[model samples]
Target chain A: MLLTDLVQELGLTPLTPQLPLDEAAGIERAYVSDLLSDVMGNAPGDGVLITVQVHANVVAVASLAAQKAIIFAMNRRPDENTCLKAAEEGIHLFSSSLPAFEIAGMLYRNGVRSLKE
Target chain B: MQLSTIISALGARVFVNHNSDTCEIDHIFAGDRMSDLLGAVSEQMLIVTHLSNQGMIRLIELMDASAICLLNGTPPCPELQEAAENAGTPLIVSPFGMYESCGIIYSLFKEDTSSL
Candidate 1:
C-alpha cells in the first residue's frame, strides 16, 4: 500500500489536505527524511516523506520533488499556518510520534511498495 | 501506542514536542551509523542513536523519519535542539545504553527486528 493510504488506514489526521503530498497518488516507495539536502540528493519520486513537523518550506520541497505524503514524527503536530500552506499546496499530511527509525522499520517490514518492488 | 508511552518505556527524556504531542507510533529503528541508515529505512519509523550532531540531523531530514531517540543518557545540545526546533523535529535523550534502551523500547512496542 502507498504511504498516503497507510496514513488514511492508520486513521491519522493531516494538517493539510490540499498539498501535493496529499493529492499525489500511486506512490510506490517510502522515504523518511529529517534533512533537506539528503532528500534532495537521494529520495525517489512519488514516495511518502516522514518527518516530525509540518513547516512551510517542506511544502516547497514536496512541490519541487513531487512527493506523495508527509508524516510528522516525535509527537510533533502541525500548526494552522502550516496546514493551510499544505492544503494550498496539495500535500498529504500525517502525524505520528513513532520516531523516524521505528516507523521506517515497520513500513519496510510491512512491505514498502517501491516501483521496482 | 502513543509516542510518549514508548519514550517513557525506553526511559528517554523528552526535550521538545514539535508535533509528537498528538502523534501515535507503531515501530522503531536503532542505530548510529549514517551509512547503515541511508536508503534502508521506512515511514513513521522512530530513530534511536547515540550520535547527536548536525550531520545526523540533516540525515534525518532526508530520511523523513518520525522521531529521534538519543541514547547513553546524552542530552541534546543547544545547537541540536535549535536545529530540531527550526525543522520541527523532536529530539529526546535516553540515559540507558544502546543495547538496554533498544531492548526496553523494542519490547514495549512489541518490535524486535531492525530496520536494516
Candidate 2:
C-alpha cells in the first residue's frame, strides 16, 4: 500500500512533515532495533526503521540503506535543527508514544512484517 | 519518509539542517558501537544511538546514511556538532530513554502498517 494510504488509515497527521520521499519508496517493510549496525547489516530495501537512539548518524545509515522512513517512539522527539536537516534530506520522520512490541504487533497484523522474515 | 516528519511526529528538537547529503529515510538502525555499523549499509536510513563522538560523525560521513537520532535527549557536543556541520551530517535529539524510544517508533510504523 502507498505510504499516504497508511497515514490516512492511521489517522496520523505528521507532526513535522517535510519534503516527500516517494518514487516508489516503499516503507511497507520494517526493521525494528536500536542497533545502528544491525540495521545497516540486515535491513532490507524500502524498510521503515523504528528505534529509540536519536542521532544525526541515523540519517547517514538510512541514507545508505535507502529506507522508506523513520519513527522515533516513546514520546521522543528531535531538536529544531535536526528537523530541518531531515526536510532537506527528504527523509520522512514520525514519532509515537507506543513501545516496540506493540508497534511491531500492529504492523505485523497489517502486513508490515519483520526483516527476519 | 522525510526526516522532518519524524521530527514532527516525535515533537523532537533539531541541531543541524540537512544538507545535500539527502534527508530521505527508510530504515532505522540503533546502536552506540561504531564497529557494529561496519558493513551494514542502509541507504537513506537513520542511525539511532547515543554516541556523540567525532568518530560517529566520521562514520556517518563514510557511510552516507540519512541522519542521526540521539536518544535520552542527549545531543552532540560542540565538537561533535562542529564535525557534523563540517561534514554536513543531519542530527536529532530525543527525550525518551532508549527502550521507550524504540517502542514509540514501532508504534507509529505499526499505526500506518495496520491500515495496509
Candidate 3:
C-alpha cells in the first residue's frame, strides 16, 4: 500500500511532515518489532516497520534495514532530534494510538504480509 | 494452541520441558527486545525470540509466560538452560529463522481464530 494511504487509513500522525511521502514507493511487507537487531536482520527492505521504540537509534536501524516508513504504535513519539535524523535519512515517521499488534493486524487485513509470505 | 503443537509445527527441539506437552498458549509475541516483550506479553503468551540468555529466563519467570522458543537453531547457553530448568520454564530451539518461525505461528493463530 502507498505510504499516504496507510497514514490515512490508520489515522497516523506524521512526525516528519517536512519530508514528502513517496508516491511511487509502495509498502508490500511489514515487520513489527521493538528490537533494533531483529529489525535490522529480519525486516524487509523498503517495507514499513511497526514498533514502539522511540529511541534515536531507531532511525539508524530503520535506515540500515532500508525501511521506507516507521509507525510508532501506542502513541509513542521520538524526540525532535530523532525525527530530524529520520527525515534526513528519507525515512518517514508516524505515530498511532493503536498498539503494535493491532497495527500489524490492520495492515495484514489490508493485504500487507510478513517477510516470509 | 498447546506448546507441544507449536514445537511440532516448528520442528523445534525441547531443551527444557515443563509440562509443555499439555501447556496451552493463547498468544504469540515474537521479538528480540525484552522491553518490548514486557509490555506486549499477556496470559499464556509464547515468546518467540532469537535471544537465549538468563535475561530471557528471568523474563519468563517474571511474566509467567507459557514458554520461550529460540529461533535459528540457536542453543541457549549453559547458564540460561540452568536458569530455565530452575524456574521450570519451557525452552525450545526452533530450526527456522525468526521470520519463518513467526510465520508458522501466525498461521496457527489465524486458523485458530477462523475456527471460532
Candidate 4:
C-alpha cells in the first residue's frame, strides 16, 4: 500500500511532508529500534522508523543515516524545536497510540516486511 | 488516520516533533539492546527501547530508522535530547511496558494474519 494510504488507514500524525507517501520505492521492509548504536551498526536505509524518543537529534540521526519516516510510539509528542528540525530536514514524523508492538503488528498485517528472522 | 491518532492510540508521550503529528508511518520494531537491533537488518523501521542515552542517537543515525520510541515511560536523557535535536529524528515515550507495548503495536499494525 502507498504511504499516504497506510497513514490514513492507521490514523497517524505526520510532523512534516518530507516523506512523501507517493514516493514509495525501495522501501521493502520495516525496522524498529530504540538504541541509536544498534541502528547505526545494523539497520538498513530502506525502511521506516518507529520509536518514542522525541528530540531533534533523532531527526538529524535519522536523516544522516537516511530513513524513510520516523514513527513515535506511546503517543510521544515532539517539541517545537524537533518539529522545526524535522521540517528543515524533510524527515517524515509519524505518531501512533498502539504502543510499540501493536503498531508493529498493524504494519506487519498491512504487508510491511521485517528484518527479523 | 493522523499520526496524532497513532501516538494517542499507542499511549506514547511526545517529547519532540509535536508538529509532526501529521507524519505517516508504515512499520515498526521493538528492542532495548542496541546489539540485537544493530545485528538485524530491515527497512522503514521504528525502534522501541527503555535506554535513554546520547549514544542511542548515534546508533539511530547509523541505522537510518524512521523514529525511536523510549519504552517504560522513561524520559530522554539530556544528551539524547541534544542528539535528537541535531539529528532531527522524532522521539516519543511510552508508559506501557516494553512487552505489552510491542504486543499492542503488533496486534494493531502487524501484517501477519496467519500468525494471529
Candidate 5:
C-alpha cells in the first residue's frame, strides 16, 4: 500500500509530515518487532516497521534496516528530536493508538507480508 | 501449540526441558530486546530471541514465560543453562534465523487458527 493510503486506512498520525507522502515508496512488507537488533538483522529493505520503540536508536536502526517508514504502536511518540532525526534520515514516522499486534494483523489482512514471504 | 511441536517444527534442540515439552504455547513474542519481551510476557507465551545470556533466563523466570527459543543455533552458556535449569524454564536452540523461525511458527499459528 502507498504510504498515504496506509496513513489514511490505519488512521495514523504523521509525526514527520514534512516528508512528502507521494514521493515515498510503496510498502508491501512489514516487520513487527521492538528489538533493534532483530530488526537490523531480519527486517526487509524498503519496508515498513511496526514497533513500540520510540527511542533515538530506533531511527538509526530503521535507517540501517532500510525501512521506509515506522509506525509507533500504542500511541507512543518519541520526543521531537527523535522525529527530527527520523525526518533527517528520510524515514517516515507515524503513530497509532493500536498495539503492535493489531497493527500487524491489519497490515497482514491488507496483503502486507513478513520478510520471509 | 505444544512446546514439543514447535521444537520439532524449528528443528530445535532442547537444552533445558523442565518437563515442559507438553506445555501449551498460546502466543509467540519474537524479539532480541528483553524490555520488549517484558511487556508482552505471559505464562503461555514462547519467546523467540537471539539473546543467550543469563538475563534471558531471568526474564523467563520473572515473567513466567512458557519457553524461550534462541535462533541462529546460538547455545546458551553453561551458567545460563544452569540458571534456566534451576528456574525450570525450557530453553531451546533453533538452527533457523530469527525471520525463518518466526515465519514457520506464525504459519503454524495460522493453520491452527484456520482449522478452528
Candidate 6:
C-alpha cells in the first residue's frame, strides 16, 4: 500500500513528506526494533520502521537501509531538531499513538508483511 | 525510509546532525564489540550497542554505519557526538537498556507467515 494510504487509513501523524507517496516500493516490509545492531544486521532494506527511538541517528539508519518511512509508536515524537534534519533528508516520518504490537497487527491487516520471513 | 524516521520510532535523542542530510539504512547490526562489526560488511547499516565513547564512535566510523544507537540510557560525551557529526554518522541515546531495546526491536522486525 502507498504511504499516504497507510497514514490515512491508520491515522498516523505525518512528520515529513520528503518521500514520494505514490511509490508502492518499500511499503511491504515493516521492521520494529530499538536495537540498532539488530536492525543493521538483519532488517531488510525498504519499508517502514517502528520503534520508540526519537533521535537523529535513527534518521541515518533509516536512510542507509533505504526504508520508505518511519512510524514512531506510543505517541512519542522526535524533537524539533531531528524532525528538521529528517525533512532535509527527504525522509517521510509519522507518529502513532498505538504501541508496536498493535501497529504490527494493523500493518498485517493492511497487507504489510515482514521482509525477514 | 530516511534516517530521521527511525528517530521517531525509537524516541531517541539526537546529539548531532544539524543539516538533516538525507540518509538511508540498508540493514542493522547489533554488537558491543567493535571487532564483530569490522568482520561484516553491509549497505547503510545501523550499529546498536551499549557502549558510548570515542572508541565506539571510531568503530562506527570504521564500519561506515549510517547511524549509532547508544542503549541503557547512556549518553555519549560532546567530543564523541562531534566526531559522529563530523564523520556524518548519526548518533542516538535510547532510554531503555540494551537488552530491552533489542527485544523491542526484534518483536516488530521478526515476522511469521501470518503477515503474509
All models: lDDT?
A: 0.63, 0.64, 0.81, 0.65, 0.81, 0.67
As for model 3, its CA RMSD to the true structure in angstroms is 3.3
After the best TM-score superposition of candidate 6, give how far the Cα of residue B69 lies from its true spot, in angstroms: 23
Model 5, B23-88: lDDT tens digits are 888877766556777887887888887777777868866777778888778788988788788778
- Which ranges in model 5 have alpha carbons more than 4 Å from their true place? A1-13, A28-44, A97-117, B96-100, B114-116
For DockQ, candidate 3 versus 4, the one ahead is: 3
RMSD of each: 12.9, 16.6, 3.3, 15.4, 3.6, 15.9
- Tens digit of per-residue lDDT, candidate 3, span B1-116: 78888899889999999899888887777666677788877877788776776678678667767688887787888887887787788899988765456666666667778522
Candidate 1 chain A, poorest ten consecutive residues by summed lDDT: A108-117
Under CAPRI classification, how is model 4 graded? incorrect
What global local distance difference test value does model 4 have? 0.65
- What TM-score, to 2 decimals, does candidate 3 have? 0.78
lDDT of 2 by residue, A1-117 (tens): 566655554443354465653453444677666667766876666777766557777767876887767777555576767767766666777776654445554555566654343
Could you tell which candidate, 4 or 6, scores higher by DockQ? 4
User: Which stretch of 10 consecutive residues in model 5 chain A shows the poorest summed lDDT?
Assistant: A100-109
Each candidate's chain A: what TM-score?
A: 0.77, 0.81, 0.95, 0.82, 0.96, 0.87
Please provide, for model 4 over A1-117, each residue's C-alpha lDDT reduced to its tens digit, 9 standing for 90 to 100: 567866887798876755566775544455566656555544457567777667557877777667767778777878878877877776678888755566666666666664433
For all predicted structures, in order, the TM-scores are 0.49, 0.48, 0.78, 0.50, 0.75, 0.48
- Which candidate comes out best when scored by DockQ? 3
Write model 1 residue lDDT over A7-80, tens digit each, in one string: 65555666664444434556566665555655565456777776653556777787676776777765667677
What's model 2's TM-score? 0.48
| Best first by TM-score, ranked | 3, 5, 4, 1, 6, 2
Candidate 6 regions exceeding 4 Å error are: A17-26, B1-116
Any idea what lDDT model 1 has?
0.63
Give RMSD (Å) of candidate 5 vs. truth. 3.6
